[model samples]
Target chain A: MNAPVLAVRNLTKLFADAARPDAMPVGVRGVSLEVARGEVVGLIGESGCGKTTLGRCIARLLDPDSGEVLVRDVPFSALKGHSLRNFRKNVQVVFQKPETCLNPRMTVAVFVREALRNFGIVANNAEARKRLVELASLVGLREAALEQYPHQLSGGERQRVAIMRALACEPELIVLDEPTSALDVSVQAQVLRTLKDLQTVVGTSFLFISHDVAVIRYMCARVLVMYLGVVVEEGPVEAVFGRPAHPYTRALLAAAPRIKPRAVDPIALRGELMLGDVRLDECPVRVRCPLAHARCVEAPPEFDLGDGHRSACWLSADTASRSVSPTAMKAAS
Target chain B: MSADAPLFQIDGLTIDSIRADRRRRIVQDVSLCVAPGQIYGLVGESGSGKSVSMMASVGLATTGLAVQAGTVRFGGVVQQAVDQRGLKQNLSHGISLLFQNAKGALSPFLATGAQVGRVLDRQAIPRADREARISELFRVVGLNHADLGGKYPHQISGGQAQRVAMACALATDPKLLIADEPTTALDVTTEREMLRFLKRLCEDRGLAIILVAHNLSLVSEYCSGLSILHAGQVVEDGDLGAIFDEPLHPYTQGLIAAVPDVDEPHELIPIAGSVWGGSADIDRCRFSHRCPFAMPRCDAGIPTGIRTRGRNVHCVLYDEAAS
Candidate 1:
């Protein structure tokens, strides 16, 4: 496999807490992943699963506590001064809520061109305006849309403007944080298609972060599932979707509301690893997993289930192959 | 109507919202029935008046929003048309509402127990009786009343908070609970637990519900009957399975097809146009432009509400059979 355009290794982000001690209860524990040019890697989990935090950390919006964020083999975290500025230009982000993300005062054209002129990506107003039009057009926004403010455009239009602004820097990576979650289901489909089209035209790698698993299933080529601020599962989207190996991933798939949930048993987790009846090393999934035994408590890091796919559970090859149906709830008593 | 009949019944309801320019009809001659122990689903996008139609029953209508004409009968008691009296006076004890946000449902200052008890206390329940009412309410919504009364809003998780909100709605021992996108704000696991708790609560003691949501898949899980709202009107209303199998209105079919399902891998066909809100073209149909099956005849005539396949559809495509 070719080396990825962006490789995040042991990417841990910890914010100092005023309430809790700095050492204990850090936000994001050791997280690791990659994004190849023209490839879309989806980050899926519930809110506070470190999806947004991870995106911010990768975009260099927030500094990591301990880990490496490599861009074109050069460490992004290692850069200082103008190099850091360059790194920022290399990776831009479109936040989850477009309404709040876009400045109410700034017109859409100004919003798109701000990044262009600031990054020195374009020399002058004429050059910046010309580039802004192209970026807007790439994301399916009209040149006339530039004259309108964020509030004037519809929810779909505003998001397209947000996407256009993200592309204005001509970044190699775009950390899209729940780009379509707020929009209506119909409008969301259009935005997703636009994102796909933009990726094809520009070959920009996206770290699309969302709490909804179904959305990532349709849009992303690869998927990464996180829990309790840790990478629980990571592999091909279809593999993780069709044959989800991780207990958490399987549970998420089962718990996800089906198109038609006639007589379907809802997936119930035992609880979060930190709060539930289990420890991190003992298997983060032990609390919720019905297949868990005493052996899971002493399991090593990531028991490979063949291929690149991996799970942290201590279940043996034979036991894992048994294929327990996740349809049954853990039965909360 | 007997008490054994549906909790809420509306034969012909027309809810309208007032814009600055003029009065515009929103929910046009809509009608549906929510029987006791039934979870009736209301599905539609924003501006579809799904929220407005249900919110009208609960007496929480937004400003510039008024039921110019709509009959809302809750617990066999008919609400007076568009007056504050219809909501607070007659159906006060009969109905309660749960908003999409649990945090918003609960006041930040008040504790969960206090909030739940507040609903009943408003109707002149003694302070001493409030404690017992709070406890029973918590049990009804599947929350531990044991010392949970003292904790403030921020102290609990979202699922627990919503459960507390459910407890609040149950405080009046309401016959009908109107939940507006209740699960929209929750995670999948938390949402599952919430719905299960609600279903079980409904099963144990009979309580009617009007669950408003955009996703039909979610509505199909629990709802026996459904009303699909579009452009501030009931485009389709009736059996959940029948509509899923054979939706009469093109808008209903489009809205149902838009939801992306986890179990079922679909191409996710999105509806063509955004909802129009200023004012209807008056003569022209609301969904005339966006509907794939729309014809030239649709632009000229106002589609009359008609029944097809046991469900009411408001569209020109179904006009031939209805006419």
Candidate 2:
């Protein structure tokens, strides 16, 4: 569309063990996805599936071992020193644990002020407080909340504070790293609403990361599903979530509760990981795919199902025609 | 009001906490009843003290806050107000806990089956039946018993580990299961499977449960009766249907309003304030300060009574005059 506000290309981040360089420490392999301008993209996967690491790397919080992260056509990996500072000002992040992320020693006002001061968004305390209030108001936080410490604020309020702090610099992109997972359901809604409202008003691109499919489906218009640090499926939120072409995506949809449990709901994966510790000759998801035949283990390629939908599974093209297109998938734009 | 006698009854329990030498109400006079086979869901936000109340009733919460005044009558017998041995004994064989993080709950070195077996052994089950019982429990929780029980905590996936934890809980066929954020650590699909399995197992075996969690829709979909805890107080308690369709309490309304519905993507209107921990100024309604629909009389009188719809609401909004 608009050449995505953020574009990632072959972004692979590896955590090589200090003791054993060959050994991978949790986040391994490499992958890349992008967020379009004024678009909410959900990165959905299980815990420790590299979604968090991807968000961090996009926000430039974690340097990729060997991958490229591009913000607005500018390769962030290519930046250094002052250029990196400019890149940092363009992209910001909000963590899952808002209270822990916040400085308990600082008041809510000071927290927002730190971001503004660091980014040169404001010069004086009065101006900083003014901007902080505007940011706080966007998230439905109270004036009195500014005076209170992180500990004094409620879980929801603390999250709002985190969002305000993230927005203090007025970045073009925000890495929402399970921003509301720690919040109460009610507070989570409020924070998400604030995020959506902020996006509508600011036109900021969001790389929303969450393990909750329903939440991702609700907040994001496009989504990319991750498995073991690899992008197995990526497509429009409605299309992919409605009728997941990928076997893993289909399995995840089947596993999600809400609708009545199906007597014979097909599981996406067969057992364990798509690709074990060692890569197979076949597709990573094939070992778990119900449709996996002898063709599975032989390096299955991602099938282009058109309509901006792509899946890294051999059976996607064959099975996409048969799977039920859930009505929830059609509820999106 | 539904069914009289239940497997476990936490009647009018109040837990007072002393933080920095200050006495405060952490769980204020919460009373709930879980039927023999019913899943009595206790839903609320982080500070709602859902965890503390459940833990305290079973003598598992923070140490300082004593059960100021309440009775935990399990198996139709009144245990001491806060006896470690008594509550634990009542909770051990009679009830078991399942946390969201099962990996942390288990030992890294020991086999998954060994963990479950150890618990069964502690409950007087013979060691010889451990493998059979472990397999049964594993199958019950949807794990591949034939292959994975011998594996360690790290051996299984998140969903598998959670099932292993569930297997450990089911080792004794305990009368009641206390699952605190059980599926919080699992993926959405795995979480869905776990929920279905747990609910089905409970129904099939008549296993009563005290399911304490923060998810309202899940509780609404599964639990029959629930108590909404807020700032150490149960602001609302009744049938899930009534609470969702027509909530009487402001806090309850606020909570329900916050859930981002799948069909309806409305922005979340988060509850305005934080929960008071160990605060002595709990004379008025615990939610009075943040209740947008609060009345002047609310500051003067603390609301603690049943609503018109046969539901308990500890708020001034339910007062006859306010109504």
Candidate 3:
């Protein structure tokens, strides 16, 4: 098989609290994932669960303290000067707030053209103009809207412009960090549909990061559940969401407000997410896990559950071997 | 008051934002009747005037906005909505409001406990019982008074700050609580917890709540009845279950179709055009521009509510007499 478009190896980044230096720094820790060519991989987590940090780190917007991000087997950090600048063209990032990310002074056309010219993606003004129109249409923006400034456009339009700017570079992979969370449901639907179609047309891999589980389920083929800086569960979207292995994943799915109510009672988590010292030896979610046991004091390895599904919980070992139901395991515990 | 009587009622409410001698009607002919201990949802998009209607109903309409017409009936007393003083007096009677940003709403200088204490002081609770009452309020919202009471708003997490805000709103033992997107800033689990807490408060204290939110699914889960507002008009209002099951209005159907369902994966059909806020005096259906089945009659005037299928829907297609 061809190499994955983007591969992150044991990436770790921590933000030291200057005011409270002794407090445990909060950020991604020893997280690793890969996005195959043209694949959409989703990262789901609550606020401050390090999903955003992970996205930023992968996009190289924020330098990681450790680990390496490789683009098609080429390490990002190994590239230097001109090579590093060239490597950046392979990945682009779309932030949550379009108003903040976009330049108020520049029109949508000029904003997108800047990216095209900066990367030398277009030969001349004629080509840039043509590319700008193409990019705008790709993200569902009308040609007329390209002439308007960020302030003149609506929230949905501004977001589409941001996406257009990212696509201007013709990057192989795009990191979308809560791209549609700020939008209204109707507008969000339009943007998501546009994105899904754009992905197929462009064949660009997407690392979709969002707190909304329903969106992740809809957009991604594979899913990773993050908690307190680590991936607790990772697998096919159907296998993971349909039959979640981790306790956090179950609680998150249960907590998501659904149009159709669930047949069974939602799995109630214990308490709110508390950010403290990151103890690598212990399970990150043990404090909130309803079925947490003494074995959880020591961190569990990623137990393979076949079909490429893996969960960082000791209980999965019984399920993999004995095919014991999760409910039965909960009952036993 | 009778057990079944509405705790709070707003009738034919209209609000106008006046600037430079020009008046733009922001909220028009909006009405809602919330019974005691009932959770009524006011669901709409940003410019739909959900917040404006609620604020004007309580006489807290911001600067440059004039309450042109409406009457608010609370507990057996009826007063004109234009009477600011009369509406303001209802706060003392039993009305409390909760905003989306709990931290911004809270006093930064005051400790969490002191904030709740200040509300109690305003309500004329005995000075001797203020501290105990504050602690009880905190506990009631599922926060530890001893641990979080002394912390300022900035020190605590978002969830704790929201609980502190909830405690302050509950200080007067309010009969009607107007929570405007209270859980929008919270995490999914935390939002669920907060909504559940609010539901329990309604059941235990007979607290009537008007939950104003832009999220249809969140409102669908907790609220028994709801009013879907669009461009300052009540497009649909009635039982939540009936509307969710068979949405009559085109805009309502578009909204329900737009929301992504977690349990069921289906194609999302977004409304073609954005919300259009029509001119104040036009009196036409604001949603007519985006309505797929728009007819010439839709341009004539804003369709009044037509009772059908156990709900009130305002649309030309639902007009039985016209048909």
On DockQ, the leading prediction is 3
lDDT of 2 by residue, A1-333 (tens): 578788887666755446555533446345667778889889988766789988888888788877698888999877899989966888889899986789989998887888899988888988987888788788788899999999887777888888888888888888899887877676577677777878899888898998877788778988998876677788987788777877778877666554122457666444444223534244555545677778665654556676778777766757443322211011001
Better of 2 and 3 by TM-score: 3
- Report model 1's TM-score to 2 decimal places: 0.92
DockQ of 3: 0.79
Over the stretch A1-333, how does candidate 1's per-residue lDDT look in tens digits? 777889988777755445544223435676777788789999988866778888888888888888889987789977889879877888889877899889999999888788888889899999988888788778888778899998889999999988888888888889999999889888887888788877888998999998888888887888888875777777788778887767778778877776567475634575433343344455556667766777766533554555556555554345344332221111111
What is candidate 3's CAPRI-style docking category based on DockQ? medium
Pairs clashing in candidate 3?
none
Please, what are the lDDT tens digits per residue for candidate 3 over residues A49-121?
8999999988888888888999888898467789889779889999999999999999988888888999899
lDDT of 2 by residue, B69-164 (tens): 788888888876567557875666688888978999999989987888888887676668767777888778777777887888875788788888
After superposition, the stretches of candidate 2 with alpha carbons farther than 4 Å from their true spots are A1-3, A16-32, A105-114, A117-149, A257-279, A291-295, A298-307, A313-333, B1-4, B80-85, B89-91, B124-139, B142-146, B277-284, B300-323
> For each model in turn, which proportion of the native inter-chain contacts is also found?
0.60, 0.52, 0.66
For candidate 3, the per-residue lDDT at B76 reads 86
Where's the lowest-lDDT run of ten residues in candidate 3 chain A? A324-333
In lDDT terms, which candidate is top? 3
True contacts kept of 3: 0.66
Q: Write the per-residue lDDT of candidate 3 for residues B1-323, one digit (tens) a residue.
A: 22268888899999998999887888889988999999999999888899988998998888899999999999889989998777997655599999999999999999999999988888688888888899899999999999899999998989999999999999988999999999999999999999999999999989999999999989888898899998888999988888999999999999989988887878888987777533345578888878899888887887778878878899989787545
